[model samples]
Structures are given as C-alpha cells and as structure tokens.
Target: MKKHIKTINGVDYLGHNALANNKIIHIKTTPSSSGKTHFYWNKGRAELIVGSKVHFPVPSIAHLERYRESFFDVGRNEIQIGDSIVWFFGKPIQPMVCATVVGARRDKGKRFLRLQPNHPDSIVPETWALYQPGNFFLVSNNRINRHRAPANIIYAAYQDELNKIEEIYAPIRTRRIILRYLTNGNLSMGEKAFKECHYELFKSIYSWAGQYRKIELVIGDRQFPTMHPSKVEKAMREFCQDFSNRYLRLVGNDRAKMLNALVYAHKELAWIHPFEDGNGRTMRLYLELVAKTRGYGFDLAASLNSKKKKRYYHFAVRKAVEGFPRILTALLNKALT
Candidate 1:
C-alpha cells in the first residue's frame, strides 16, 4: 500500500487521495474527537478522516509548515488506498471531526498522497489569504481595502454619529436605528417615522447630545474615476430595490429566520457597493439591525476587528459572484451563533 501524510492545525497525519472531499479539501478534527485515534473528514471543522485515501500533487515541506501555522491544534495521520469515508454531516455529531482538507502529501510512497494541515491548495487557505489582508487594512487604515480614503473617513464619522444617536434614544431602539442606518441610510418613510418617533420620545433624556461629527473625507476620484455621482446613485437604487425585494421574499418577521435572511442579503448588498461612501459599514449595520430585530444583537465593530473579517468578506464576495453561499453562510452563522 502507498503511504501518505496528512496534517491538521500543526499535527501531521498520513492519508491518501481517497481521503479528500470532492467538495472541499482542508479537513478539521472534531473537538469531541480530540485525542481520539480515528479521524474523519469534517466540513465544519475542516478535518480529513484518518485512513482516508487522497490524491495530491507533490507538496513542499515549507508548504506543510505554512499550513500548520494558519490553523490551531494541528495533527497528522495516515490512510490507505480504496478507503471510503464520510465527507460531511447532515447533523452535528458528537466526538465527530468536521474539517476541510487543506493539503495532501504527495510523491512520498508509490502512488500515495499525504494530507497536510493548512494546505495551500485548500479552500480555507485562499479564504485565509483574503481574510488576512482585510484584517491588516482595518488595523492599519481602519477600514477594508478597495474603498477610497474619503469613504472610510465618512464611515468612521457615521459610526461616531451612531454613538450620538444612541445617547439620545432608548438603547434598544437606538441600536435598531443604527443597524438600519448602517445597512441603508435612507430607511422607508414609515421606518424613518418610527425611528423619529422614538427619538422624540427620548429627546428630553438626551437633549444634551451633540450632532454627529465628521471625519476628514478622502476622495476616490483618482483611484476609480468611473465611480462618478451618477454611477453611485444608480448603484444605490439597484441595491435598494434588490434588498427590499429580497427582504420581502426571504426574510421572516421572526428573529432567527431574519438573521439568516440578513446574512444572505448582506452578502448581496456588499457586492452591490450601493453607497459611494460606506458600503462595508452599511452592510455590517444592516446585519446588526436584522440581528437586533430578531433578538440576536451583535457588535459588528468587534467582529470586523478580528482576523476572520477578511475571510468573511471573501466569502461574501464569492457568494455574490460565484453563487456559492455555503462558506459565506457558514461563517455568518458561526459569527451570529
């Protein structure tokens, strides 16, 4: 039998091409299966099953090392040819491993492949590369890349404005308005009226609160000259129409269902880049509002601050362009849940 090595997190295991999932590669061991002798392919955890056969092009040792550093609690094991294993689960299984195969050790034994943790060939690797850059942008520039500095500044300013809004309203309702403002600044007339009514009711309590401040705006005219005012307006209208239509069709009045609905909607809206100034901020705000309405409130600022933000954004883009919502939806569910 040909021998191959497989790794997860940092740990290395041996397996062959028979282990790889047709849908995704980078498999993860289940938390419940920690320290267990047998491993399996897990979509949720990104693990490959022990004793699974995998086929891989040759991989370098450096590639193996890079893979382990990206994920936590890495391991490796081996598998033989002609072995069949479960790839994904319909329901959560205790002591079950759920991971995508990230890498495979190839050309080691005659006709055998090895699985490596954090494989560059894995989907998670591509997603992680995208995620990391987004993280760096947020940390260094306080926003995601591809936006003009002015837009980022405007977004920052709006966030400050939201803070002021909170001071003048009930915490719950204030949060809801902030969510709507972030998602779509121009709420429907009725929604706007509802927010204004709440604002009036609490004016006495927060009369001293000042107007939202402005950040120094940077223009993207030099970078994306085609993004003129007219183009922006068109984009916004399209975005609004799509969002409203989708919301009506898919979103339920309940909270949990709405949460899922918002996740999908946010992905679509982000792709639209409806606003000339603050789409990222808006999408997050939209998601937050949907969450709050459903009683599953979130602090998106904190979530966006994490390294995973890049992964989240990449997934969103992929879902928008490629029609693959699995990774994007999974990440959103993970974030909210």
Candidate 2:
C-alpha cells in the first residue's frame, strides 16, 4: 500500500499512485461466510453480520446499494486514484473528515472500492458525521452532483477556507494532469513537461506558476543559485538537454548506479529551483517519472508517511545540493521495487 498524500489544515489529499475512486467513509462491517468483511453502508455505520439472523434489524443487501453509492462516487469524471472527498456533519468535536480513493473493484453489476482514511491510530475510533448538501457547499456543488455521493465535501473551514481548500487540493488536480501525460502516448520528460504539470499545480494562486523564478532566493542560511529572470530560458534549455542525457544513460538496474542517476537529476532540478513554491512538489513528481523509466514505483505513500524519513529526505536533498549524493541515492534505492 504505497501512499502519497499530505494534509493541509487537517484535510488529507491524495498525491500518489493512480488508485481509482478513493474517498473518506464511515461504515460498519461483519464477518461474512466468504471470509471477506461485509461492510454495512446504510446509517453511516457497519457491523459484521455474524449469524444468519440474530433478531437484529439487519438491512438487506438491497439497502446497501444506496449506501455503497454514497460511499463510492461512481460514473463521475473517471474518478482516478489520488482524488479526495470530504464528509462533514457540521459538529464541533469531529465535524469534518476527508479520505482518498485507494483501490477499486467490480462485482456483479456493482462497483466497489477501498478507501484509505486520513486519520491515524491515535484516533482509532474516528467517526465522520457526513453533512448533506443542504448544510454545506461542496466544491463540486455547482458543478453537477455526478458522483451520487451522500456527503458534502468542504476541504477547508478555517480562515480563507475556500482558497485554502483549493490550495490543499491543488496537488490532486495537478497530479491528474500529470497522470494523463504519463498514460498518454506522448512520452516526453524534460523541463517543459515538468513546467506544464507545475503550472497546473499552482496556476490559480501564482502569477509565475509555471515559469522559472526571477531574482534569487535562499533556504535558511543556504543561498541557492537561481537564474536571473532574463537568462532563465537559456538555462532551462541546457538543463533539459542534460536531463535527457542522464535519463538516456540509465542502464541495467545496477541499483547504486541507477540511484545515483536518479539522485543527480533531482538534485540538479532542485538546485535550479525552477518554480518558486512548487519546485519541491513538482520535483517529487518528476522523480516518480524518472523511477518509472526503470519500472520502479516511487510512490509518495511509503516516502512521506514517516517523521524520521521526512527529516532524512530533507537531509538527503541537502546532501544532493552539495556533491554528496550518496544519501539521496541510497534513499531512492530503497524505494525502488
């Protein structure tokens, strides 16, 4: 279960592998004779159906049709894997909840999916009180309720809630655009390709979303070399040509060699700091594409889920900025296959 996701103001958005139809859901389940868990979808609760009939008002599988539809939004914009959904009940304690679509399946005439919750073990008994459309304004509200879901999604409710929510989900929308490129016949990987995706990620917010940064910037005490706004075009040209060279040079999976190549490309891109804010995120996406060149799934899930590893990732990237890329190479090597 490789997971690539991040939480903004407590809302989780999927930014990883293309798992179709993921969302946050609250349901009860019971042991069915088939050994797989039978989830109770109605009433926003579920329990394992133990015995055939134990005098409980067990809802029929027919009733589950409605609940299943609510939990998983089918037939709505081709629901890719990393997309997110929120279900809020307008309560204080645990008013709003979000989740991602992890996996999907089709049985008989129905479609089913596996949803990964955005909560942790600390809140094991997490319950989402789903808000109906009447109480909330979903981003998808005016856009047609094609998913047939029972819950209303509101990603942010804090200050500048709508804008913040858009920022949070930007990765999702951007990832979709990149996914299309990856799956499309056009197999180009270079600065322009990355810029297109970066633009999608930060388009609504930044005027220079897709373009290279002007002037210069620093990270803490480290002042990175950023191209002057005027020279960005030529620098990017050389950079992309060099990237293509390195990618073409990738050979049989000598793990260390492959990793070194991967680390070098990422290090070079980050050093360029191509775009202002989304350079890091877009680079992560580019690295995934690089890994794909060698049939590796460098998913964000196993990469960003750990506090310790995140620190190490930063450390490795810093090492890459210098000449010492062994750490970053080693980290990326571990993520392969």
Candidate 3:
C-alpha cells in the first residue's frame, strides 16, 4: 500500500531494506482451505510453492518498480550494494549510461562508487567515479546478479589519503639522521635547492617528487589559485634572486630586516606552490635551513599548533601576496628561537 511497497500474488514485497543474502524477504499466504490467511516470511528470488502451484511468481513489474526506488539519491550518505546510478558525461548530446554500484570507497571525505555498466559497450565496467553531490541520479538496481554476491558486504569503504601521506612522513618524525639529512644540506637558496629538498624527502614515495605540477592547483576553502605551471619557474627564479639579495644578507644580525625578508620569501613561495606535493614540508625545511645558516634554531611547529593560528596562516598566505605580509610577519616572529 506504500509508494513502492506492494503485495502481488499473495506475497508482500518491501523496497530496498528487506535485502540480505541477495534475496528480498516476502510474506507468503499459507493455504489451509480456511477463510483465515496465515502469514509466512520467505527469502528467495524464486517462486514460493504452497500446494504444488507457484505462490510468489517470478519478478513482475511491481518487483521492478521496487528495484527502481532502491537507488542512492544524490547527497545521501548511505550507499547500498546494487544501488543504481546514471552517469551523464559532459553535455546533453553525449551518451548517458546506466551503471550499478558494485562498490563504494571513500578518499579524503569524498565517496567514490565502483560501477559495473549494464552493457559491455557502455562505460568501462571497472571505473570508479567520484560520487559528488548533484552528480548522479537513480536508475534500476541489478536484480539478476544477486546470486554471486560475496559474504558480509559492508557499504561504506573509507581509505583516508592523509593516512598514506602520514605514513611517508612517519620515519622522518621518529629518526634523527633523516632529519639531519633534510635540514643539514649546504645547498644555496635557489630553485635547484628547493627541488632537491622535495626530491630527498619524497622520492621514496612519489614518482613526481621534485617535479613542478603540470596540472592546475587550487588551495583551501577559498580555492585560491596558486601560480600557473607556465609561470612557476619564473616566479621561483625571481623569489630566489630576492631571497639571495635581501634575506641572505640580513641572516645574522638585522633581525628586523631578516624577518621582513623571511615573511616575503614565505609568502611568495607559498603562492607559487611549485611542486605538486610536499610544498608545505619543503617550505618548512627551507625556513629551518635559513635559521641554521645563521647558527640559530627556528622551530616552525611552535607557531602552527592552534586552529586559530592555522586559519590566520591560510588567510595570510593568499592575502599577503596580494597586499602586505603583516599577519604573516606576526606569525613568523613566533617561530624565531
């Protein structure tokens, strides 16, 4: 009697939720030749036999309708196995195809659905599409392949990408020699030194280590565009020239001038965002090396602990390059030993 729930041929079929062991639970009517109808819950896709005749017929239009309503609606948190999805590629003229959600995986707070196309000629069956909000719509669920399901299939598959990045950084935190190798290099402040720092730290994990990012990059909630790849080299060269001229000369004594140059250097490099990854780590290492060049210790971690500090730093990184480095100067002053 519900919108999608229906009883057909003496068996009650509910939508979606009654699924387990790849079978829909259906309530059957027990035949006793009596006026009273006795209820029985049956679990199977096949017909139920009461008196040598079929009680639950093979899937009808009502069953098909129930399957249609079981798909994951856009923006819904709970994604179930066999939920239908339709991927519309680009413009309206492009072919829209139907795929069944065979698996769901999470990376960095976003859900990705591993889909199997209904037809072999459609989109690649092995594709994992990102399930972003407003990107998908409901289609018919797969009722045919219900027999081949694996045991104990849970819907939410979460693999945090940050955890993988932390795994790469774990050894550097625990070991002193690794830290020494990173910070003790006598490389002069230049583009080569910056690339080398990125390489030495992340070459073990990333193939693109020390390489400038070819693709476009946007940072944080504001989606601030870092320097385009075409302009990265030019920006880095200019920053290095300024760093060598102004910041390097003031390294030992003039704390006021040195800090001002340091703030500019930090702001410029962060805006450039040269490498695809490890830019933050590389910048921190560069700052520490700058401190060491003058026989002083600068612990950048001291100023980066609080949420408010991080929020302001994120704002300053973008704003400082556009205007003045006032907030960044205040933040960097805290890092001085």
Ranking by lDDT: 3, 2, 1
Position 98, candidate 2: lDDT:
44
TM match of model 3 to true structure: 0.50
Give, for candidate 1, the lowest lDDT window spanning 10 residues: 134-143
How many clashes in candidate 2? 17
lDDT of 3 at 233: 81
lDDT string, candidate 2, 1-337, tens digits: 2122222231221222221132322222322345433232212222112223233333222222222222133234333222344433345443444443433434565555444444342121333222233323223211122222211133222222333344465567756865776687576777767787677766643566787776565643356454455666677788788767865465466666666667777787767776655576677777776667555667655666676877778778888888788887777777766
Model 2 TM-score? 0.48
Best by lDDT: 3
**Model 3 C-alpha lDDT per residue in residues 1-337, reported as the tens digit of each score:** 2212343442212233323332333222222335323222233433222223334432321231112221223334434435455554343332343455544445688766666554444434456777754556543333223232111111111112222333334346424333564576665667776777677666543567778888778876577888899998887888898898877876667677667767877888888999876677777777766665666556766565676776777777677878778877887887765
Preferred candidate (lDDT higher): 2 or 3? 3
Candidate 1 lDDT tens digits, 1-337: 3232343343333233453333223333322334322223334444333434444422212223222211222222222211111121122321111122233333434222231212232222111111111111111111122221222211212232233223223355555566555566555522333224334323332332121112222222343222333354455555556655756345555545665576656655554444333345445545655565445656544344555776566545555545677766655666674
**Which candidate, 1 or 3, has the higher TM-score?**
3
- If both were scored by lDDT, which would come out higher, candidate 1 or candidate 2? 2
